[model samples]
Target: MGLAGLRIVLVEPAGPINVGSIARAMKNFGLQQLVLVNPQCDRLSVEALRMAVHAKEILESAVIVATLPEALQGCVRAVATTARVRDWEAPLENPRTALPWLIEQPTQPAALIFGREDRGLSNEELNYAQRFIRIPTSESYASLNLATAVAICCYELAQYAESPEIQTPQETELAPLELVESYYQQLESLLLNIGYLYPHTAASRMEKFRQIYNRTHLQTKEVTMLLGILRQVEWALKTPRKDEKL
Candidate 1:
């Protein structure tokens, strides 16, 4: 099978030609889903359409959303590409090693996120992904065009999409990313209400929490259990204890 379940997400991409080129590349690799998160350029512009050539259908059918969360709706796995080293707990992996994992759950939707052409993904944006990638290049010229990066990853996806030897056994149904994101929001609110995280520091502290949870690949039931605990804790904080009433 091909990578039909994988969604390619571009975050605030600015170049029309680049977007078109990515669509054409996706067509070449048998990928169809294209999602644009607040694109800065008109995807259907002449330049884009011309570059897309025979792949114009992919561009026309692309999903445009206002936020990253919206673009990632219903996905079970997400891998983000980055070029710079950051102070994060997650180690940067190569495209060959990490791309295969995305297709392991072929029945469920997955996402591959590429960031802005100028700055790439921000720290907050990076938090949304379960894994990270950094394509190797010569030290003298490390920068890569956005479309080039997508094409390279697409090539890798096509190469391994049908390899039975690379498929990992699915032991359980993984939780949807939206479900896990909801839990994170609730957990952050509870922590802030209880003064565990101040307004000034909640984001950085939550980054650590995300890094921990992202690695777990929590199941759907596991996330529900976690949400239940958060809701109960929230209720407890509002309710007066028997001793306090006395």
Candidate 2:
């Protein structure tokens, strides 16, 4: 169902073997979309192709982008897998619980993001995702291989693909990520102008604002309303008050 619309996004994957294995896992679970963001290794390398096996087509047709935002261009929903915990308000869920949410509806495109092999997603990259997933592992050896992580998540995603209970359609059309992102840029500028955020601290402060708005799942009109408010604020700040002329 929604598997068709799901995109597996790997950010800066450094190992061709891992990238190839991930492609195979995706194909095994009926996923067709693979997005590689600034990959450090060649997806078509001999090692990569060897691991991909019958899934070479997945590698051949994979979409390569320069950045995470570009990878998520038209996606309405995104979930990022992380290994580190931060002070943010977003909850870190496991694969089964969160993976299903990605494919809840088949109509719109969604994304599941994985980070670099050496280090997981940074806080800035994590901000682009509305949901976060952290796989549970043993206390002794907590780290997971990049390819292994993708396989585990893919298996869970495939399980949910056959289940009809979670297929309830979304009520409203959520705003495209591009629209939401534009609002963030506008809001940040407005905040800077009003001194709510300083030049050095804008990025961190905006992460909080992102978390707040992301939780609301704002629709297109809702985002438009917010943009209008920001525009009015910008205008109000530029125009002198009636008494200021004196």
Q: lDDT for model 2, please.
A: 0.91
Report the lDDT tens digits of candidate 2 across residue range 1-246. Answer: 379679999999999999999989998989999999998999999999999999999999999999999999998899999998889789999888988878776787899999998888998899899999999999899999999999999999989888766646755788999899999999999999899999999999999899999888888999999999999989999999999975
- TM-scores of the models, in the given order? 0.97, 0.97
- lDDT accuracy of residue 156 in candidate 2: 97
* Tens digits of per-residue lDDT for model 1, 138-160: 99999999999999999999999
**Global lDDT of model 1:** 0.94
Candidate 2 deviant stretches above 4 angstroms: none
Error of 1 at 15 (Å): 0.5
lDDT of 1 at 127: 92
